[model samples]
Target chain A: MEISYRDMITVLHGMGFGVLFMLAFSGAIGVIYATAVVGPHWPRSKWDNAMFRFYLISMAALAWLATISGAYIIYPWYRAVPPAGTADLSTYPRALLLSNPHTAGWHDVGMEWKEHIAWFTPIAMTMVAYVFIKYGPRLALHRQMRNAVLGFTAVAFFSTAVAGLFGAFLNKYAPVRGGPDIVLMREN
Target chain B: MSVEQQPTGSGAAAILAAGMGSLALGVFAFAGDAVPALGRAFTFWQPTGALSGVTITAIAVWLISWFVLSRRWASRDVRLGPVNAAAFAMLAAALLLTFPPVMDALQGK
Candidate 1:
């Protein structure tokens, strides 16, 4: 069973947008935590606290889901296709799918780094969630604790940004040159 | 330090969970790159090392650290603050382990 290039493109594009959304939410947690409170003063109100909680949990979930989904789809596809140099000519289509043919710049290097580090984003995000959920209202009253949570969220935001950037870079450079760009085997 | 809510058993659990999550990610990446490579090496099958060797190494680094660090403070309750160091280490080690593969891709070797 194979897919058309159009469908492949669509899947990649959809994954990209999903990751962007994940980044936005992850960043939102850090931004909100910073200016909103420094402890002592506590949350502005119950409403504000509720909203903050919502964003924190959402960021955690979104980042993990996006990270897992992207890893699931992209890495496996690369694995399935043997490199043209390593495999026979009959396996050209697999090798020609995502990776670039020539090493002009940081294209491949940047992506490999991105894929590896991106794994930890979910773990970091989980810490963000753990700190927020277990501590609860106390986080608003204690300045030091608040800062710790802030640091975690900030880290989360940074990692997600890195992942998103590398993912886009890889996508832009995918498709081997001087080879069949799309090998359609009927779209299902 | 003055806070009443300091040091609890739960912190270690949370930190451990994070470490495990990192381990899972690393292992998955390794498996992704390894399976293919293994098949190609052994049989006519063009196995492309489904698991990434880099990721496996990263996981080993993480697991060892988790064991060593937990032992370092096994008697005392793990605080979130101190555990941050472990988290950071795990994150850094993961990225560092994967550097070679990325370089290979960039060099097109």
Candidate 2:
């Protein structure tokens, strides 16, 4: 098995960070809902509270890592302009998609929307983490604050879902490929 | 602090600041996409193009606003009704502004 450097990084960005972050949402929402909605009946000791805070903070960190890597690392490669009159545009994912009318929307709508909307995830998630950490069990006492936290969490999930969906489809249509091949194994 | 003694101001500040940050990002992104000059100006890093500046600036706006608001409201209990309304409105606007179709329609494209 072998994989190129670019492909490896792309997979890490989307699968490692992005998908992991999305998967964490279910546990996060469940715990948060239990704490806020179920109120004092949730059976959270100090240890449980500490663990939940750590989980939320980690989610926020994952969100930051995903978007940062996408924007700074993978995006530059994806948007790299091909050399003049280049026959092969495979190295430039953005250009490859734009060059064909059938796939142009993938770049126009998919990339443009994904790149920008994905950012909302980190911003909203950070707030959700901070608010939850600050209020904890007390959140149930403040109905408005609890509502705001829940609302932002839902929005963050929606933003992430949109970005993740587009990312998967974009890669399917015009993948970011080309780099030094790293061989994993060779048949004798 | 007990649950009754805990103030809501700090949480409110964080919420409002997030909304502000979201709005800042949407506005910067929309402007960068619609205006060539602004787009070029926002290119702080050549490799990443305008995105580098847009995200960094929005983060700065978020953190700064959060710090300022937190400092001012840390111990006080502020009315959340108006704050929640304003923050949610901005959040909705940010969502709409970042959508390409909405942006295109507003730009008459």
Candidate 3:
């Protein structure tokens, strides 16, 4: 209800990351779908092409929502503290569970989900990529699909680049504030 | 090019109906944040409050656009081409940019 500057910035930033995450993830999946999944079993009609396009668009939207719920909240929270190897929060006053690994439970849940999604992201994208590359070129209605793929792929690359830059920025400016190692450790 | 006959009246009616329906629902979804009685009933519609409003408004915008486009290009195979792709990417990018990454940056790794 109350919109502070900080909240505004957070929402805006989260939205950006959410969109970036969706575009990149969808693009990557389109590539995989084209080369892997759809190549051999490519469709043969206009209906099929339309359906595939619909599928990709829907999937992209799903990835956007899922990643937003999982990553934007959890990843940022997890990063609030420095990496475990570099620093320890065990000595802090009241030993806030936000920083404490021993007592907190849900703290790691978000990060775990975030990491889990991150891990599976490439696999899912591969499936999407297959659709784009395979059916994309051969559609009777080639123009729309082709244009979509080109746009999708461009976002895939650009967003990934931007993500890396943001990653680096976090490393320098915010630095990892330590928290429970539940999710990170479990994934590794 | 296969030319499908455009929907002259029924299609326009359908689009209008769908657009208005979506717009109404979206409005209802957000009405709770302001009105106390509606707020109680609809608060559950969106646990997160304002975020739900944003979602409703965004969806309504898209639906309205779709309705207009459908009316304009009814029955004709929508000529989706590179332009659509570029436009979609740009739109997505603009939306993404507004989702400032700094907070996520501060919150988690």
Candidate 4:
């Protein structure tokens, strides 16, 4: 098996960081809901509080990593302009999609939307993490604040879902597929 | 801080600032797409095109607003009802404004 360096980085950005961040949402929402909605009835300890803080902080970090890597690392490669009269546009995912009528919408709609919308995830999640950490279990006492936090978290999830869906579809249609090859295994 | 003693202002600041940050991103993105000059202006990084500038500016807006609002409201208990309503409205606007179709419609494209 072999994979190009670019492909590897794309996988890490999409699966390693993006999907992992999305998965973290389930745990985050559940815990936050339990803490805020269930209130004092839920069992609590200093350890639990500390662990939740770490969890939220980690999620925020993952969100930042995903968007940063996507924007700075992989995106440059994906959107690189092909030199004049370049026959093969495969290396440029954006151009490759735009060159074809059928796939044009994938770039116009999918990439255009994904590029901007994905950002909201990090911004929203960072606030959620900070607010939760700042208030801790005391968040349960402030009903409106709790509702706002939950609403923001939900929006973060929605933003992530939109970005992730488009990212997956874009890769499937026009993959970012170049760079030095790294051989994983040599078949005899 | 104890439940009774904790101030909601800090949390409110964060929430409102996130909403504002999101709104800034949407506005910047819409302007960048609609106006060619604005698009070129937002190309702070050549490789990433306008995206680099758009996100950086939005983040700066978010952080600065958060800092200013937090400093002002940290100690006091601010009303959250209006704040939540405003924040959620901005969040919704951000979602719509980032969408290409919605952007296209607004631009009469």
Q: Please list the residue runs of candidate 2 whose C-alpha ends up more than 4 Å from where it truly belongs after superposition.
A: A41-43, B1-4
- Candidate 1 lands at a TM-score of 0.60
How close is every model to the real structure, measured as TM-score?
Answer: 0.60, 0.97, 0.37, 0.97
C-alpha lDDT of residue A101 in model 3: 61
Ranking by TM-score: 4, 2, 1, 3
How would the candidate models be sorted by lDDT, starting from the highest? 4, 2, 1, 3
lDDT winner between candidates 1 and 4: 4
Please tell me which model should have the higher TM-score, number 1 or number 2: 2
Alpha carbon deviation, residue B64, candidate 4 (Å): 0.3
Candidate 4 lDDT tens digits, B1-109? 2344488889999999999999999999999999999999999999999999899999999999999999999999999999999999998999899999999999998
Query: Candidate 3: global Cα-lDDT?
Result: 0.40
**What's the fnat for candidate 2, on a 0 to 1 scale?**
0.63
lDDT of 1 at A171: 49
Worst 10 residues of 4 chain A by lDDT: A35-44
Question: Candidate 4 docking: what grade?
Answer: medium
Report the alpha-carbon TM-score of model 3 versus the true structure.
0.37
lDDT of 2 at A28: 84
| Best prediction by DockQ | 4
Top candidate on lDDT is 4
Instruction: Give the interface RMSD values of the models in order.
Output: 5.5, 2.1, 11.9, 2.0
Q: What is the lDDT of candidate 4?
A: 0.91
Error of 1 at A162 (Å): 2.7
| Candidate 4 structure quality by residue, lDDT tens digits, A27-118 | 98898889766784342777888898999999999999999999999999989999999999989899999999999999899999999999
Model 2 lDDT per residue over A116-183, tens place: 99999999999999998888878877888878888888899999888889999999988989889989
Q: After superposition, how far is residue A126 of candidate 2 from its true place, in Å?
A: 0.8
